[model samples]
Target: MPPTVHDRPRDDRGYPVPAITPWEDGRPQFALTDYQRSADCARQRQCSVCDVLMPRGPVWRVVGAAESAAIGAALAAGRPYRNLAPTLEGPGHRACMLYASMVCPYLARPNARRALTAEHPDELTAAVVRGAVRGALGAVVGFADYEFAVTGSRVLFRFVDVIEYLPHDNADAHLAELRAELAGHGGGPARPVG
Candidate 1:
C-alpha cells in the first residue's frame, strides 16, 4: 500500500520527506532543493512530490498570500502576469501540491516563521531571508502554464495565464483534524523543525 502523506518517513525533526528535498551528508535538508532534480522535474514536467510526469495543462504551484493577490489582480485586469515574479519551487500535480501544503509545517501554519541558519550561505538562503522579511499569513494554490528560468543554480518558475487561485486561511482547522488523526494513529502533532 502506498504510504499516506502522514506515513512518509520523517526527518529527525519529524518533517515528512518530499521526493524533491535534497540530501546532504546522508541527511535530508528540507530547507534546500536539489537543483539537478528540480531542473529535471521542470524539464520533464514532473510533480515535485510524486516525481511523476504531469498531464499537459495548467501546472499548480503554491505561493505566498501577497504574490497570490498580485497574480489575482493581474488576471482580473487582463494584464500579463507571466514572469511577473519568480517562484522558488517548480510546479506539481494539484493533489501533490495539496498534500504538500497539508503536511508541510511552514505552509500549514499561517503564522509559521521560517528559521534562518547561518551555516549555509547560498541563493536559497538569501531567498529564505527575503521570505522571512515579507512574512506569510497563509498560502495560495494556483494553476497556470509555466516556463522555467535558471538564475544561478536555481530553477525558478514563471506562471503564464493563471486560471485559478485558492487561498488557504492557513489551514488551521484542517491542521487540527490532521493532528487528531495522527494522535489516533499513535503519532502526535508534527513537531516544529529548524
Candidate 2:
C-alpha cells in the first residue's frame, strides 16, 4: 500500500503520486516513493517522498555513507554538484524527509561495507551536475557546486547513478521490511521486491 493523502494535497486523482524517472527511451518510471527530479521546470521545491510541492523553504536531504564517499570522489575528480539531484538525496519538506529516513529501505539498512563488497560492488558512480535554487518562483537554475552537510546518520548526496538491486546476505529481509513499511503506511500493494 502507498501513503494515503487523507489530509494532504495530491495530484488531480487524489492518489499518492510517486516521483518519476525519465528513461532513455523517454518512458517514465514511477518509484514507489518520491525520488528527486531536476528542478529545471520550477519543480525543485517538490518533496520527493510525498509527491507534493514543499509548502516552505530550507530543503532537507538524507545521504548514506556509500554516497558520501562517492560524492567526495566525484568532487575530487572535478565534477561539480550543478543542481543535479543527488541519487541519494533530493529536495523535500521537513516531514517528508523524516518519513523517508525512517521507512525507505535504501536508507533504513545499515551501510554496505565498501571494502567487503569490492569483489562485486552493487553501487554505480556517475558524473552529474547539481542545480542551484534561484528567485521566488522556486526555480532552480545554474549548474554550480552546492554545499552539503552530514548530520548523524543522514548525509547529503546530489548526483546521478542508479541503484539496481544490490546483492547482500540480508537483501531479501530488507526488501520485506520495506514492503511492510509501505503497507503499514497505507500505500497500495507492495511490489514483490525492492
Candidate 3:
C-alpha cells in the first residue's frame, strides 16, 4: 500500500513533505503528486486541483497566443512538442477546468505585459481531460501535438498542449455560462462531495 500522508515528514506548516526513510536523506519539501503513490496507484494520475484521477478523453489546456503558435508549429512539422524539460502538471477534468477558470487567481491576474518575452512564460497553460482511466491525467501515454514555452535560458521543454483557449478577459463569463449549462445537466462543481 502507498504510504499515507502521515508516513511523510511535515514542514513548519505541518503539511506533508516527501517520504523519506531518514531525515538526513530527504529534502526539506517535495510537491506531492500521483507519481508518489505506490505502484498500483501511481499508474493513475490525479488532477492537481481535484485530487481525482483524470478521466480519459480529450484533455483541455487554456493557452494564449504563444502557446497556440507552438502547438500549431509542432503539428505542422509533425514533431513531438520538444523542450528542455517536462513542466506539464499532468491533466484535469473539464468541470475542474471550468471551475478553475472561474476562480483561479493566476488566470484572473492582469497581464504582466502585452507581448511575449523571454523573461517569463509567454503562455499560460492548464489541462482538462476526459475518458481518462481511473480519471488519471498521467494515464495519457502520449500527446499528438507539441507545446512549449521559451525560457530565458533559451531552452525549451515539451510543454502541455492547449486543447482550448480561454481568454482572460472573458474567462469569468465563459465559465459562468458553462456552469449554468452544467447545472442544467445536473452537474456541479468539482469539489469533493463530502
**lDDT of every model, 2 decimals:** 0.62, 0.36, 0.37
Question: Candidate 3: lDDT over CA atoms?
Answer: 0.37
Off by over 4 Å in 1: 1-15, 75-80, 117-127, 130-137, 172-194
- lDDT by residue (1-194, candidate 2, tens digit) is 33432344334444433343333333333332122343321244455555566543244444554444444455557654333543434555433443444444444345422211122222322221122111111111111123344434233444322211122222233344345445565233322212
Which of the numbered candidates is closest to the native, going by highest lDDT?
1
Tell me the deviation in Å of residue 14 in model 2: 15
Better of 2 and 3 by TM-score: 3
Candidate 1 on 19-47: residue-level lDDT in tens?
67888877887766788889888888887
In candidate 2, stretches whose alpha carbon ends up further than 4 angstroms from where it belongs are 1-17, 21-44, 66-88, 111-194
Least accurate 10 contiguous residues by lDDT in model 1? 185-194
Model 3, which residues run further than 4 Å from truth? 1-42, 68-85, 112-163, 184-194
Tens digit per residue, CA lDDT, model 3, 54-132 = 4544343344334435555665576544334454343344555455444433333333222222223334222222211
